[model samples]
Target: MKMTVFGAGYLGATHAACMAELGHEVLGVDTNRGKLAKLEAGDVPFYEPGLPEVLRRNIDQGRLNFTDSYAEAAAWAKTHFIAVGTPQKKGEFGADLSYIDAVIDELVPLLTDDAVLFGKSTVPVGTAARLTTRVSQLARDVDVEVSWNPEFLREGYAVADTLHPDRLVLGTRPGGRAEQVAREIYASLIVDGVPLLVTDLATAELVKVSANAFLATKISFINAVAEVCEAAGADIAALSDAIGRDPRIGRQFLNAGIGFGGGCLPKDIRAFMARAGELGADQALTLLREVDGINMRRRTRMVEIVRAASGTLIGSRIAVLGAAFKPGSDDVRDSPALNVAGQLQLNGAAVTVYDPHAMDNSRRLFPTLDYSTSAMEACEGADSVLVLTEWPEFVSLDPTSVSDVARGRNIIDGRYCLNRQDWESAGWTYHA
Candidate 1:
């Protein structure tokens, strides 16, 4: 199978590499010259575990390659995967479809007859159906078919998620070539018992946002419970454990932390709300606004707890552990950890931040905060340490050693990743 993947950012780049690794000929297209240069040099722009090796191997084997030319991409593959970004529109909750629209506007005219374009980008529900008509009008003497196959891979474990998805969803026109081509493209997953759900374009487009909204709701649900736990003097970790035993309420995203703030979740829910409003179903998703508020409140509450613990944050030295939204990937689009760190800094706290792979990216986004090469270095003589993001390194940190480094022996377990008993045993005041 030969495929052209548009947008060589996190989603597109990972999809291209993973597709090539699946024994397909892939050409990744992006307009960013620097990103293209890096991809051409076999370098991944972001940190996704095991991606660089996969990228380098596939590129070396001549199966995965990248170019900036949409003309070349159109000519190269009959199956074109649009894995572009649909970031939130500024000042509006809806998604900005300029990139997806641009892709069709440019590629439709250039595509030959008998081509199928699969949009793997997460968009509003009606986008694919609209794109079908949009592409038909734009195409030059070509029968262009549009399909919605939303990508379900999370940032940290994207490669694995893509390669071995829980289920494969496709939204296409009735009995179209897109469905047949999609099966061929994902033959390995199909053989491995991955459920392939084919539906109308609207449902397929809604599926990705629905999945993300579910994840966000789960996190917010537990965080909402965490609030009750705080009031009732109950531990959220224990509560999550109790809830996890119930098969009906299986605990995957029940992580009670500073809350979810990744590239997905926050914006996807917002866009979903805006779309519902536009569709005249404003009351359908009114709870999502509350969900978003709960998630945001967790961050604010974390800062308040830290400030209360440290007396006056006016000149307090605070160390923030884990800058990335979550571990395994170095993306901080709406990172809760960094947001709290920045809020703390803005309120006059001397903040020191640390992450295994997110330091450079965090520093670029937040140059004011002091960054250290090591977690221990970040904690060196700090008045208090905030375990903002739950990374394995932070979770596995020796409590006594970390307490020994901090000036005040006080730790705020923002993500609830640490054991309170161990920190207290280590002569440190642990607050979760």
Candidate 2:
């Protein structure tokens, strides 16, 4: 199989490389020359565990290539995947679809033969139908089929998730050839028993958003319970452990922390709400507003915890232990860790931040805060050590060792990753 993936961002790059690894010839297209050059040179611009190796190996084997020309991409392959970003609109909850629109406007007109465009970016429901109409207008004599094949790759474990997805979904018009083409492209996975759910365009479009909404609701639900646990002086960790034992309510996203803030969850739920409102079914998803509020409140609550621990925010030095949204990746988009660091800085506290891979990205997003090369360096002379993202290094840090470098012995476990008994045993005042 031969294919071209548009947009060399996180999702696109990984999908392109993984497709090549699956024994398909793939070309990655992007307008950013710098990003394309990085991919060409076998470098991943962003951090994802095991991605650089897979990308470099595929490039070395001559199975994957990159380019900036849409005409060249259209001419090279009959199958295309749109993995562009659909970020939340500025000052609005709806998704910004200009990137997807650009891909359609640029590629469809240049198609010299029959093709199938599989949409991988998360978007509002009805986008596939809307874009199907758009393609009809832009395409010429040759048939161009539009299908919705939304991606469900998590940021940290994207490569594995892509290659061995729990399930595969294809949303296409009834009686179209898109399903046959998609089956051929993902034949390897299908042979391995990865369930493929074929559905109408509208159902496929709704699948990704609904999954994200459920996940966000689960996370916020646990965080909301954590709020109750706080007021009643109950141990959330123990309560979570006990409730998680129930076969019905699993404990996957139940970790009571500063809450989720990545490229997907925050924007996806908001877009889901905004789209529901546009469809006049806004009342159905109204509780998501409270979910969004609960997630954001956790960040503020973390700040309050720090303030109370320090007794005074003015001139306090706070060492923030994580900058990325979650461990195993360096993505800081809407990161709860960085958000807390920024808020602490605004409230007259001097903040030093450290993350294994997110430091460079965090610096670009937030330049005012101090950055350190090591966790101990960030903790040096700090009034309180805040564990924001539960990176393994931070979770396993020896409290006694950190105590030697710090001016104060206050430990705030925002992610609930730290062992309270060990920190308390080390004579440190612990706050989770």
Candidate 3:
């Protein structure tokens, strides 16, 4: 299989490399020459576990390459995958579809032969069908089948997810060869027993956003209960453990934390709601408004906790232990930890932040805050140590060592990942 993946960002880069690893020749197309150069040199622009090796190996094997020209990409392959970003519109809940539209507009007009363009970007419902019409207008004499095959890759585990997806989905229009083309493209995974669900275009576009919305709802639900637990003085960790044991309510995403803040969950849910309203079904997803509210509230709650821990935010030296949205990846977009750090700083707290992988990105996104090379360095002379991202290094930190250098022994576990007894016994005040 030879295919071109538009937008060589996180999703496209991973998909391109993984497809090449699956014995396909893949050309990653991106407008950013710097990003394309990085990909071409086997250097991943972002942090993802095991992605560097996969990308480097595939590039070394000559199965993967990158380009900036849409005409070159069009001439290279009859199959194309759109994995561009669909970020939320500025000051609006709806997603900005200009990136996808750009890909379609730039790439479709160059297709010299029959092609199948698969969408792996998470989009609002009816996007594929709408784009199918647009493709017809631009493709001219060339027959281009526009289909939806939304991606479900977690940031840190993208490689594994792509190489061994739990399931495969393909959405196609009537009388199109997308189903056959997609199956042949993913034949290796299909042979490995990965379930494949074929559906209409609208259904496939809805699946990705719906899954993200559900996940955001679950995280917010747990955080909402954590709020109650705080008032009643109940242990959210213990409560979560008890409820998670139920077969119907699995333990995944149930951990009471500061909240989920990544590129996907936050914006996807908002776009989902906005799209529903546009479709005259806004009332159906009204509860998602509360879900978004709860998630944002969790970040404010953490700031309040930090203030209480330090007695006041003014002139306080706070050590923020993590900056990435999650532990395994260095993506700081809408990161809850970084959000709190910024808020604390805005409140006149002298905040020093440290993360194993996200320091560079965090520094770029937030330059005012002090950045430390190591966790211990960040905690040095701090009034309170806040573990915000639940990284393994932070969770496993020696409380005694951290307390040794800090002016105060106030430890706030924003992720509920630390051992309460160990920190408490170490003469540190533990707050989650």
lDDT of 1 by residue, 1-432 (tens): 999999999999999999999999999999999999999998999999878999999999999989999889989988999988899999999999999999999998998767999999999989988899999899888888999999888888888998999999999899689889988989988999999999999999888999899888999999999999999999889889999989999978888989998778898999999999999998989999999999999999998999999998999999999999988889988899999999999999999999999988898989888998999999998999989888889988898788778898888998888877888898889898
Q: Give a tens-digit lDDT track for model 3, residues 1-432.
A: 999999888899999999999999999999899998888888999999999999999999999999998889999999999999999999999999999999999889888899999999999998988898899999969899999999998989999999999989888988899999999999999999998999999998888888899999999999999999999999888998999999899889999989999899999999999999999999999999999999999999899989988999999999999999998899999999999999999999999999999989998999999999999999999999999998899999998998889999899999999999999999999888
TM-score of each: 0.98, 0.99, 0.99
Better of 1 and 2 by lDDT: 2
| Residue-wise C-alpha lDDT for candidate 2, range 284-392, written one tens digit per residue | 9999999999999999999999999999899999999999999988999999999999999999999999999998999999999999999999999999999999999
TM-score of 1: 0.98
Off by over 4 Å in 3: none
Better of 1 and 3 by lDDT: 3
lDDT of each: 0.91, 0.95, 0.93
Clashing pairs in 1: none
Residue 215 of model 2 has an lDDT of 91
Q: Which model scores highest in lDDT? A: 2
Model 2 vs. true fold: TM = 0.99
Model 3's lDDT to the true fold? 0.93
